[model samples]
Target: MADVETLHAIADAAASLQVLIQDAIEWKRQHLTDDLLSALIAAEDEGDALTADEMGEQVALLYLAGHETTVNLVGNAVLALLRHPDQLELLRRDPGLDAVAMEEFLRFDSPVQMSRRITLDELTLGDKTIEPGAFVVLGLASSNRDPRHFGPSADRLDLGRVDAGDHLSFGGGHHYCLGAALAKLEGQTAVGRLARRFERIELAGEPVYNGRINLRGLASLPLAVG
Candidate 1:
């Protein structure tokens, strides 16, 4: 069937990424000294119970998580600035607000849209009961924009918000995203670079969105810079 073929294609891409991670790890072990690979190897040597396959899985996870999320965060932040001229001007005037600008940008259009978890037991949420084994998709984007939590114009992108740190874009609780700090740093760096370079930037065309509903981000965004 066509659906089966499409799934196979996706799986193949994922497998290829895994292979790339393995190759990168080998390269690091040969070329560089201290890095994520080195840290993982050290942990393995220190009586860590992970098998070879498990170690591969760990590296694969890091590669996928770190690569895709950081890329999306930067891309999404650029897209946001392109859409909002006023916000861009604000950043242009006050360069020191890069950190706050990045946070506000992320909150406005998070690279990661949603994540999943299963109900451990029957838990009531509003009128519905999340039965055990029920797959619950947490909408991080929606939660970030909740009017009750973020005040009146929850959807508005305001860089001046002092408590911008409360956004659920990085998730919450147990799985609060390991690469949160790294993603923020990348966003800050990329946005600062772009702000310094272009006086005005606008979207040239409609952005290409990933078909995946879970891993939401722009696949491509053509921008008109001036």
Candidate 2:
């Protein structure tokens, strides 16, 4: 159950995003090119696949899924490395470790924590039996930290962990995130350059979270850099 304040916060945030989505669509209309927005626009103009209203809907989902979520991915990566200096130093010492470290960061604290799924058929797993049409909330973070696949040190951050890249952060199967590769590459570049560029990056104050339910991320990450 959500309190009035929480409901209001969500409503406010959604409204702001809708404004941004409209702005993006308008911008893309003025400057059509061979890009994502143009591609979506073509779907409506050429193929007649998406209605004008649904064009807005698809833009909202893509922007939220692609751009908004990546913000958290980088933020989460930096925070994780800060909490584990040894891990941060590993990247600082070896730029090659950036890619590997990003994987561990995703596993350590997945940017998006939960995914919603409807059971297609009856299924039994462990001790619980879920009936068909059951709505299940998959915990990406929980599965990433499972000891069964990640070993006893699953709870700890290990940049060199053999299976660290095999996380559920981008989901799996046909529903797998199309932007997973780009997201990982961006995370590697951002966190890597940040560590190498700064002589010192230390926490200046407590971090504040954005309070989004599905896309877990920091609203502000205070730091002192030299």
Candidate 3:
């Protein structure tokens, strides 16, 4: 447990990082380059360039999405594999199952548990009628385990499951995750490489959760690998 002072320090550090990201966005706007930041800065639709604040927000989102989400994805996948040895052994036996295994890992334990959305207009979903501007929170993790979509054994991890890619771990529609492909590649490579390099991998002690309500991942995972 972190003390009040430590919590304050963490908050301050996060604020500082936000400032730095905004500064970088402004810097990139002036000195346009071929990188992602420059591309976002210079992006225009029908000669309508993005506002400075919009650019900053987009850049910040890209940074966090590219870094934290992928870290959590890998961590959650490794933890899931550790918990399910049979699945781990199956993956170890067939390295070619990396892609599908990645999908199962994502479905079994989504890094992002929820997403918030605002109603654009009055909408009726099932029994509930949501008015315009109403706030809606989607439970992505729960959706992944939905028996209607994933069948009766949805709770179980099956690397060979074909419909595992249908999971909403990467979101859907226009607001889908921008770094989805990159994240998947990173996760596949990390899990596959770790399994290939380690003949025996076991948990050294109990894993510690990050304690974040939205993001699910391990704060520290002790592993014994040979």
Once model 3 is optimally superposed onto the true structure by TM-score, how far is the C-alpha of residue 114 displaced, in angstroms? 0.6
Over 120-220, each residue of candidate 2 has an lDDT whose tens digit, in order, gives 99999999999999999999989999999898999998888878998999988888998898999998999899999998999999999999887889999
Model 3 quality (TM-score): 0.86
What's the C-alpha lDDT at position 39 in model 1?
83
Tens digit of per-residue lDDT, candidate 1, span 1-226: 3598899999998788778777876776667566768888777768898766777898888778888888888887887777777878888888899998888877888778888898889999899878899989999888888989889988887888876778888888898888888888888988888887887677889999876676677789888888
Candidate 3 lDDT over residue span 22-111, tens digit each: 887667668986777766655642356677666656767788878888899898999888888998899899989999999999999999
TM-score of each: 0.88, 0.88, 0.86
Top candidate by lDDT = 2
Candidate 1 Cα lDDT to native: 0.82
Return the lDDT, model 3, position 138: 94
Backbone clash total, candidate 3: 0
> Which lDDT value does model 3 have at 177?
89
After superposition, the stretches of candidate 2 with alpha carbons farther than 4 Å from their true spots are 1-23
Model 3 bad stretches (over 4 Å): 1-11, 22-34, 44-48, 51-53
Candidate 3 — worst ten consecutive residues by lDDT sum?
40-49
What TM-score does candidate 1 get on C-alpha atoms? 0.88
